[model samples]
Target: EVTVKGRFLNQRVAPCQLEVRGAAAVWGDDGRLTQWLSTQHAQGTVAPIAAANGVAETQVHILTPDVGGGFGAKIGAYPEELLLGVIAKKVGRAVKWRETRSESMVALGHGRAQLQYITLGGTKAGKVTHYQLWAIQDSGGFADMGTILAPFMTRPMSSGVYAIPNIECRTTSVVTNTTPVVAYRGAGRPEATAAIERAMDLFAFEIGMDPAEVRRINLIPKFLEPHTTVVGQTYDVGDYETALDKALQVAGYTELRAEQAKRRARGDAKQLGIGVSVYVEITGGVGNGESAKVEVLDDGRAVVYTGTSPHGQGHDTAWSMLVQEQTGIPMDKIELVWGDTDLVPIGTGTMGSRSLQQGGNAVFAVAGELVNKAKSVAARILEVSEADVVLDKDRGAFHVVGTPAVTKTWADLAIAEKSTGGLNHNDVINVSGATFPFGAHVAVVEVDTETGKVRHIAHTACDDAGKVLNPLLLEGQIHGGVAQGAAQALLEEVMYDADANPITSNLADYGFISAAELPSVTVVHMETPTPVNLLGAKGIGESGTIGSTPALQSAVVDAVSHLGVRNIEMPCTAERVWQAIQAAR
Candidate 1:
């Protein structure tokens, strides 16, 4: 039997605060308060302010312009935001507030900061049989979104990609004199994945087996139908093994192992280590669904209004592509609008990797509906039966099925409907359930045994995001996610002394990752379409972070494991690595 135990820390994210932005409000004489803010969710900001000020929801209005960055910090309504309206009414004038960079670091909500205790038991033959986990979450002086993450996010994914027959998990959140915890990029899922991956590596070390092979022997088989785990979490579909195979092949896993062996034989001070991680996460699961509006102007240009706010996710380009694909409108002619309560009053407001899967799905559905509406108008203008009219998608026109020359363009149809509500379609789309996007990542590192300095040499990531609409955008998202993941594993951390005074409170003190520190990542593409939404797409927003954090951490530990080291805590700094090595010797 093999027994492995370790404590994994998902350190707090302090720098993910509102940057160079402010909120302004004016109390109008008509008993309406209009405000403009830098936030990911304008609708989310409206209701709270209205309720706190003792006014109807319609009395409060919010408009969010281009936000620099949110990650997850701007999703909720803050005390200052709720007080802006009251302050404006009291002063009888417009009021505005913006935090300095130093203040933003401590005032804004933090993320992660969970301490996990994990244990795994398995046979000598490399089959994991039982797994147990206990997570202690730091809610940070207030019960916020981070309080429920352990139960709703970590516990549900405790089984991970493996088919362990017996599993037990428990979670507890304790209030501490730290910054309030909120969702970061991968939120609770990353912490869950990190815990399980660490346990798997430790178990492999105990049995003297290759970690990758141990994982392969225990992974869940690919399933098309919804499959539920022992922990009662149901996955829509997953092909974890295929993702693993692709990652290994792309990373030249055999050559890496051979190099490591040679280094060990020569007793080289610098050692090569390879690490692997397979992960599946939930997306498009935040709310019931999303809302979208598609309209054709008289000039034939299309417009899309979505409830999903875009801080930096490139929603304008993505939503336009969906409109062009469905309605035959050119990408350049499409316009996107969002984040204003008057313009887009109903919205779920982009979190949980839900934008592309839910918001884009809604746009795809509404644009298709607009096409049908245009066809009906075209049939009336051509004086033909609706069944006889056929749309020439390449030409963006409609005509009789047999005749191609005489056609009605989208502009013409819009002009004809000008007397009516115009050519427009808007609706809130509801999907059956959430989507699970799975992937694999392999990280290669060179560690100096004497000094315990680690250098990330190579990385290969295979993320299956389910029917990618735009490869450029997908790759960009993957690259960004990888950078953040690497930061959490090897560079970034938020620390405080015993009295709760932050030690690394500002950028100068924080170990933020930079481009110079990261290797050029090789992204391996794989697609498995989902049946839950119309576009058959899943979320790529958080996959890179989910896979890379564990891979990097595992690589650092594996580099010095021959010295009898079982594990080292995250942000595997040189000091920590050296301490572990000396203790092991």
Candidate 2:
């Protein structure tokens, strides 16, 4: 039996296609499209699509409507999309091409098919000193980002929440005649957490130490500034020990352990298992910046153009809040426009948890600039020097210093500017840097030794993604991410037969998780703001996914630890668990 079973299968969903219509054409200088289809980078597509078509970049006009749901799979422009325009031009009619769900499964991008081997060493006293990981990534028919990025992403986070002195991680991506790999919720970072956390547990078990205490002994001391790991990840700020403490406290770790001991003493048929995982992930995507423009329209309403395209990160509401905070415009008066490159000519687009820190920072920066412009305009209009102007956020108006009686509404200043020129303020926030978001998750499960059934009971998590801008949205992201992570550990996987044909190809065959399989999560809040961006924030988008996957997988293994079970692979199906139990016997 493998002493260390670390299959951190933190992956996301498959591609589902819909009927698409229209002629794909280049945009003319008149800022009109010859024809179009659905995409996020409407304006951003012009140059690249035109170049590919041997036409002027100016000929491409892309339009993006609010997507139904992409998760990350729909971001690329495939050969089929390029062919749509060509076929339309050839046939002289609007071209419609839609793939069946089965076709999408085979042709579209797939997420997170990785195999990892981990080894961790520490003192018998439970102080982890070293870690090593080797991974094999299934790139599938083509070399997509998943094959190239996941393993590289794995190295930076190789040590996870522990302060290991020596660490090494190596991965090889091999292509197969299968669906191309792509980015999922947590991408490569989840695998790192999975490996390290499991190794920590194995170390703890071998040394007869409590898992929680082992984690505490090895975590980096709390740092208010950036802390660089031996692996070369510079965390802007973190309180990993506190996150572990909070998660343990919330899960009643001591009580659970006591219960576990009594159950073990009695040789109970149903065993209680507890799992813990602490993780820190890099966000904002390797220094790629985002863009935004805050324009005070002639009508006094605020319009924000941003490059961070969101599938469901609530960019609209979040961007509006950022603009209103700086510009003294009511949330209702602020409008967010994006994905239409004509309206927002430049943007990096959203993926990799970059929308807020990069995209929102751009909006915040430019909105502050717009307010400065408004201050000057208000000063001139109110017969006061620019230095004498101040903004009253409560009133959404600007007034002369110490002269509240003379005020100008944001709308009034915009109308004045439109009479002369445009552009109150516009800027693109560029950062050749990244932010790290950290968290701890605990999972409780009950395993039926007789039938080898695993039932997830309760879950508790403490995710610190820096300063939270919106608690509701952050929690929503956490809930969704946790679900996906848990599913990967216990129920989900993309499988192939001996012939390299897919076995789990559809919903009927694939183990897509539903509410019936999960328990509500208890979230403990914490924040250690990153200095990486102006928002004092990190990425919460993938935090839960990275943390929860290992926690659940470890819990299942923990439940059967008394059975001499050391490791069990992911999607811990009853059959697999039973087989492990039998082999141990």
Candidate 3:
């Protein structure tokens, strides 16, 4: 039996630096208030702004322009944003507010300031059967979204990819004088992964077993149907072991371990360490559903309106592709509209990795519905039954089953329906349930024992986000996710003085990860379509961040584990590693 315990410090960091908080509000000639802000959820902004200003939801209109990045920081409406309209009405003119870099650090909600205690018990042969985790969350000055993440996000995914029989998790939130915490990239999911992964590594160390082998033994068997964990969180579908095998193959796990053995035998100053992690996360699990509308214009072009706002995720390209695939319209001719309340009207915004699975699924469903509506128009013009007319899809036109030469194009259908509402379909699409996107990661690092400096030399990530829509877009999400996860593991921390004042408020003092510090990532693709959504796609947005964090952390710790160093807090800087080594000696 083996049990290990430590605090996984999820240091705070600014959500996004490129785009700070800014808002413009105007009290129009009418009683309604028109406000424009950088936010993830436009519909979400309506209720709060309406309540604060003592107006109806219809009276408040929110328009979201191009947002640089949200990372959950911009999801909630801030006091500054809420006051913009009130201030504008009082001043009798349009009001605009932009936060300075220094102001944004304090004003923006922080993320991932949690302390975790984890314990694992099993046989000496590496069959993990029991697990327990206790998370003490820092809610900061307010009981915001951060307050509930521990129980909601962390506790639900406590079992991860392991088939541990008995598991227990406890969460407690405390109000601190520091900045209020909100959701970050991975939010509470990363904290959960970090805790269990670190425990697994310690368990491996005690039994003198390979960490990878230990994980392989404990991973849940492949499942195509729904499977519920001991914590009562049921996953839609997962094939965790295949993902692990693929990641190991791509990363050359055996070769890396061989090199580490050689370095250990020679007592080299620079030691090689290989870390592996298999992760499963819940996505498309938040909110009621998403809204989507597809309309064919008089000029034959198509327009897609989505409830999922795009800050940086390529919703335009991806959504357009879904429309084009259904309507046979060229992608260049397809346009996407979002973020404007006057336009979208209803939205859950883009967070929790719900955009593609929920929002994109909406687009795909509505586009298909539009095609069906168009077929009736084609049948009316052709003087035939609706069943007799079929869409060619190649030409974006409808034709008789046996007569391809004669076709009625989308423009023709739009012109015929001009007397009515034209060729369009709009609705809110709901999924059967949340999907589980699972994956594995391999992180290889070189640690210099003398200086206690570590270099992340290689990383291979295999993420199964269900059926992929766009390979390029999927890769972009995974790459960005890996970078962010790697940043939290190696560098980036929000520091505070004794008086609860932030000292690392600016970029100069903060340890933000740069492209120079990251190695070119190797991404492996895996697909296990979920039955919950029409598009069969889960979420790739947070998978890399979730899987890579623990792998990188484990790699850093494994590098010095032979030196009697069991654990080190995150942002494993040279100083921290050096201190850990000295303490071990």
Q: Cα lDDT for residue 88, model 3?
A: 88
lDDT of 3 by residue, 256-373 (tens): 8888989998999999878899899988878757999998889899888999999889999999999988888889989999988998998899999999989999999899889888
lDDT of 2 by residue, 1-585 (tens): 123334444343463423222224543446434535455445545665666666666555666666655556666676676766666566655556665666667667888777777777767777777777887888878788877755578777887777889888888888888888887666788877887887888888888777778888999998887788988888778888999999999999999999988998999999999999888898887346777788887677888888877667899999999988897688998888887766777877776788788888888888888888888888888888899889999898888777788788877888877768764677777765888889899999999988889999999989998888999999988998888888888988777899988887777887878888899999999988777778887888888889998899889989999889977888888998999999999
Superposing every Cα of model 3 onto the true structure, what RMSD results? Answer: 1.1
**lDDT values of the candidates?**
0.90, 0.78, 0.89
Per-prediction CA RMSD (Å): 1.2, 2.8, 1.1
TM-score of each: 0.98, 0.94, 0.98
Error of 3 at 436 (Å): 0.7
Comparing 1 and 3 on lDDT, the stronger one: 1
- Name the lDDT value of residue 528 in candidate 1: 91
User: 162-215 in candidate 1: lDDT tens per residue?
Assistant: 999999999999999988998888789999999999999999999999999999
Q: Kindly provide the TM-score of model 2 when superposed on the true structure, using C-alpha atoms.
A: 0.94
Candidate 3, residue 50: the lDDT equals 94
What is the Cα-based lDDT of residue 38 in candidate 3? 90
* Candidate 1 lowest-lDDT run of ten: 13-22
Of the two candidates 1 and 2, the one with more favorable TM-score, higher being better, is: 1
Question: What does candidate 1 score on TM?
Answer: 0.98
Error of 1 at 21 (Å): 4.5
Candidate with maximal lDDT: 1
CA lDDT for candidate 3: 0.89
